[model samples]
Target: MSGTLNQILNGHLSLYGDLPPIPIGAYDSGLNKTQRQFRRANKISLLEHLATEGWDHFRRQESVATGLDRYHPTKLPTINPGVLTSKYLLLVIDGTTHRAQSLAVTGGWEHVVSCSLANMNSLPNLLRDYSAEWISICHASDILANGALHALAGHLQQAKTNTVMTCDDIIVRQLWNDGLGYEHRQYRSSVSAIRLCTRGGIGGLLTLDYSLFKQCSFAPSYTCLEALRLDVLLQITREPIKTTHCHQALVKHQGSKNPSMPEQGWPRERCPFSDKQLDEIDRIKSQHAKQYFGIEGGLKPNPLQAGCHDLSRPTDESSLVSILIPFRDQVELTSTCVKSIQQNAGKSCNYEIILIDNGSADNSTIEWIKKAIKEDNIQCIRLDEEFNYSRLNNRARQLCKGDFLLFLNNDIEFVSESILDVLLDPFAHPKTVAVGSRLNYPDGSIQHQGVVIIPGERRCVLEPGKHLKEQEVIA
Candidate 1:
């Protein structure tokens, strides 16, 4: 590895702690022996030349050949190619408006620049001006860690062919509550079949070489930039282009705020979506789904499963469940909760209990939990902090090794023996993601059957009396 590239790798390791060992020449292994040797020789020569002649002299030399060739009619002034020796353009697009922000100057990047989705034709012109070999397109609000840029640069340097790279982003959602004020929730992105069916492919950041960018520029008249980008990406699957995903959350998406749209309708000339255009988009998605997931007709199985099932377990112990319950100092309630699961669920059901103790002051409760762990009856996780319902469940999820995860409250007890069977039955279908059971008070009156949004009320209400019968409800 070159000194610069090695430094970049070390910087990433520092920020993320230890990372898995990366295979050397993994990107270029496909190249023939001669091609690989020639490329390496050229890279070494270029590095040596850059070190001796300085950037300005190299830029001036490349400028002499600018007017000799024109790839497109929208020709722009070409910068000295040497200026982009070690840099890659970081193109940040506004997710809502599909317009690029001029963040290059602020980021102190000579090659990076923003552009509107409609004028993506001018991308070729911009690339020519900056002479950037690679470009990374991401949302304007994405917060990149310190070493993210270096990692991307290193990837571009090692990539043998035209490649598109994507990484998971930490999605942060913010909401204003009437009583609690502003609330922020952060979670890792988990793209599921249901989400894909509704929203389409991983629709976030993408990095690609300039050659691939030219092939997949935004359509000038496309109104929905998100749909257009997805289509473009899917279109490339037919070609020999390589696509890869980085597992780490290199970018943080500020999903709480919407970008300001241009006063003039997007695309400058707001084109109405015709029926034919809409159909074409759907057809493209269908093709993508079939090619990628082997699902015909681009349709997911109906996740909704209605009707009750008799309390029975399959001969095979495939349906293992992890019951996660968060507990504090209430030893009596916690003990009762465990006993209820044991009695109602019975030995027939394949389930394990995960008790999360969050700063319990009572010694009796702590000792009992420890005893349960020692006996191997239940798994106990200790958290010496205040109660955070979201964090507690999120942490417990990592420890769970079940096919299905069930989250419960310590104060609640299972009332019916058939509840687990009923809930597990729905998940037999591939589309069913979550199942909620009816909650009843001690008196047997309904506490919550389902939630109903009253149109004018501006608040959703727990339907206490209605939706009593077994039926499918819109989430």
Candidate 2:
């Protein structure tokens, strides 16, 4: 069963060259072909017919219901605005907020209401394959633990070109910088000014703020160049949030080669702040306490005074250091890491272990720390939720008392405390935003020297490794 998928994706090995091929289609059987193909060709198709009758499973998760079933194709309606007035297309985003999706373009903001349906069929080549975090974007709904709408919003805003041939030799250049979707983003960032000039003059003007729009909301449910400006009062939540709903919950997934079937007779009216229907939300926001304290009034202690690069704190070259380990759910490795830290240290520096029990699912680690907390300051910050590496580390950083902030992964353990003397000494020189320690596995081999994001991979690669050091050795 898995072999069939391997052949399908491995055929794309020509695309990656020296880099290994990835199994993107392994988990996507329901999206393309299921094992039922040998017996019933139309089995998957029959499922789609029943799905539309009454089903909320595929509401945000878009995929051809019949693709795996093979019995029926999803029924989608095509209505040209030139043909109908009230007959409008509606799209609903999974309630997650992607900053790019919810951008309400104000000045010179002309909205596009149609998608380049033809260009959308182009797949990866449509935008010249600029490779813009596309690996993450293509499977964003899946890569993310939460909603994919927020990620979709960012993709639509980031796309530079999306054009298709039109009647009478016309070239339709879609100009939708601001759009509303499952995600949210500001238009003013990338393009400086993002507003369409005119598209057959049927849409809103380019010089108006669509949020103030009481009449026409954005149009075209999903596209790089189109966004419907539906008037609502509720503002889209910009904080990248997640829902407990697992990816397995989605009946199907949309992919680069494997596209999602559009749900017909569906409407996308609900969004955070799209002239939302909420009457008292404004009052509720005003009444919320955080906005007034840290937000409206500015920092309590001028952050500049506290200083990010303060040299006056400790010049001992080796003092009490604060090590922050932000982690969640990896009991085996985490236990090994904790013990390593407890045991090793080439230097005797006063240091406190800030194990940010970053929403760990394993209560055993939390329990062990609590027993030890009888003496040390193990501030157990229960997130009450899940993991978001950036947010968790930043929160832990604020509580750190050490003169330096050292973020270590829970999977790692310090092999050299003398390395800290070197690590902190460079910070003393004052220009380093971050200084990394030389890390290694028990095999006496280098695990990491520093970290840098290798573009197109979407994950950070260890800068110093076997291959990298070999190049240096050869040089």
Candidate 3:
């Protein structure tokens, strides 16, 4: 590993050099911080070389190519290369204004059919006419990303029964909400299908087993019929279907020309819902949660309009949470954090703040800690050893006396009164391992919304949408 890295660092060798290609195990097995640094530095060049000449070289032989090349150009010459032999069918729904021909169908589809609010009932009938094993549906206005159809076809190979696969979209133009720009909306795996079903449809670019359509009874009046109807159908049925949002950006939304178009209910570009619609949406959301997740009242009362479920154990009412704060000697920051918790803890449940002091030497901080311990009724533990963050939290975890644990930093200050409840709501589900909150800087800029992984020659972590305004939500 060192030798290969040195060659790249010193510009002494190419990927075609005497050494074999860097094995995937080389990343995991042998590498110190310096060795890893060298690999990270040269990742871009290595990836670019692999994509062009190296990939072409391997693909020409076909036998020597890695498993990663299955979706490459050499493998799938066209979207539906073997439509006659393949069991999958790509069905494009030609909307009222945008017909199938206007769409970027370069990837290709098996068939295109006209659809409207009047003829929405004909969907099941149209689906029944197809003899394909798996059926993919998309709107005519929605452009297919390069290799999207082939990717969907590839996905169906191992897809389970009742699994509806939706892909991330690149929003080309959205005139609604006074917004017009390009944005890639990537779905989070942790987000529940129930949360999306009532809010909005996933999108038109989705594929499922042909038979799964039979399980849903469509209402003729539903405007956003393509993907929304299918999603709602899966939710209403007694049997549950897993909603898998593909990580690949497989669809491109051409954007809605008008804001008020009922048929074009794309995720971020939808018009405002009427009071009646909101009521109906809320009722459906509550019903789904009560039926599926066994939440007592459907949605937990949260400041965030998209209410979450309280899936904690039924018998254990009012869960006691232990808030763990680890700090070294920033007395001012620590004081503010404690004050915020005291003021905005809300009425969710009882909680105890366990402040772990990691060898604070400042006289003011030590004095404040002593006063806080006696007056604030908060527990304080002193670790006189070297500052080890993980060790400090682990030590505090041992003394926590709550049903759930919240590891908070001393630099954090709550802006929302319901922050604690919002954080605890997801814990209602017993299988939940952990929940993360969107953090913002003091200046109202995002500190962290979520962590995303960037896969390359070497995998790396990215804090995407890190510095965006607090108002802008990432999908």
Candidate 4:
């Protein structure tokens, strides 16, 4: 192990862990004080070299090329790249692996730890998400205490710097509110899921359990974030943060059940995944890979495949859909409603059914669902208010992520093909926000145009959501 890891770890434990914070100046990877040490230890003649050279000396591509090109006759041509992503002129010492599944964005001097493992394919998904400005693949196998120190030393001795900056442009987010915690939830089954996946304690990247590799923990803001593409960790100046909000870590919807909800309504509180989270991980990966990357052969490395699930314990991740069923204790109707939804919902999207029990006689509905499928996908929300349809739907919508929401009644039965691709196609357009369908009673008479919001009224009662052409609604 490199001495770098020990010093950093000890410094971390003593300073941030149990000891007081280190009163050090700013610490970024590229222009770090440590890197300066590496530079100093290495080429002391670097200053002389720079003094004798001009800007043109660094700009030429010839400077970066490996002189020993004749060694491996079959090796693919390597691009000795330099990066200007941050104000600092980040330079790439090496390039990432040229894996077919692994995507390399043009332009950068950064390196990803994903290469630490040999069998692991290419740079990680998070780095690709950014198509990072500058990065390279220099796999560091040794977990040394002074690993950073050595790397800096190597850089100084081995290579010369074209330009050094005061700091980096952006930093990988590892704050409490970041999504790393949420992503790992796919690894958990019950409370265990919540604990293992929580991002608060993990602090930064590259150090969590297998869960760190999963994409769910990747915050939404971190789109196109390939793990390799990320710049080295920044050592920032410290300042106290003022927290605004904290999410109720895991949903404890058991006691918070709505008063009106009947016994046979929603699923019970168990875990996020049914037969453990591992079952659902790959599914989530495959589905998402198709969505973003499409069937194209060459692209970036597909995201990690651990949080997705199988049929026995399916996990939903296509686009999150929240099914909010607001009902009074009509057990029979509730069962019928849930059954219909479960039957019709084939695996194109992730569906979460939140049953808001307005007020019910018994609570069998939640328990029955729990037994049937401990899919962390489902939730039973107990509402505190009476059956105010509009309010409940609004609340659910806020939580919903589906491109289009499905508001089904306890009595309504989907007899024919549900909105697959054609009917709700208008939603593809940004302007087409809501679509009204032709609603019909069991006997086939027009029950609703799918909506009719009276003057100043809050609710838009479904006039119809059945078979109808787009023009029919316009007329």
Model 3, runs deviating above 4 Å: 1-80, 89-115, 118-128, 143-151, 158-162, 168-204, 226-254, 257-286, 295-317, 361-363, 375-377, 428-430, 450-464, 473-475
lDDT by residue (349-370, candidate 3, tens digit) is 6788899999899999999998
TM-score of each: 0.36, 0.30, 0.62, 0.28
Q: Identify the runs in model 4 with alpha carbons over 4 angstroms from their true place.
A: 1-317, 363-373, 397-403, 418-423, 449-475
CA lDDT of every candidate = 0.49, 0.31, 0.53, 0.31
Better of 1 and 3 by lDDT: 3
The order of the candidates by lDDT, greatest first, is: 3, 1, 2, 4
Record all residue pairs in model 3 with backbone atoms less than 3 Å apart, i.e. clashing.
Answer: 311-428, 311-429, 312-428
**Which candidate number maximizes TM-score?**
3
Quote model 2's TM-score: 0.30
Evaluate model 1: give its lDDT: 0.49
Which 10 consecutive positions of candidate 1 have the poorest summed lDDT?
A: 64-73
Candidate 2, superposed: residue stretches over 4 Å from native: 1-318, 346-348, 361-363, 375-377, 441-447, 451-472
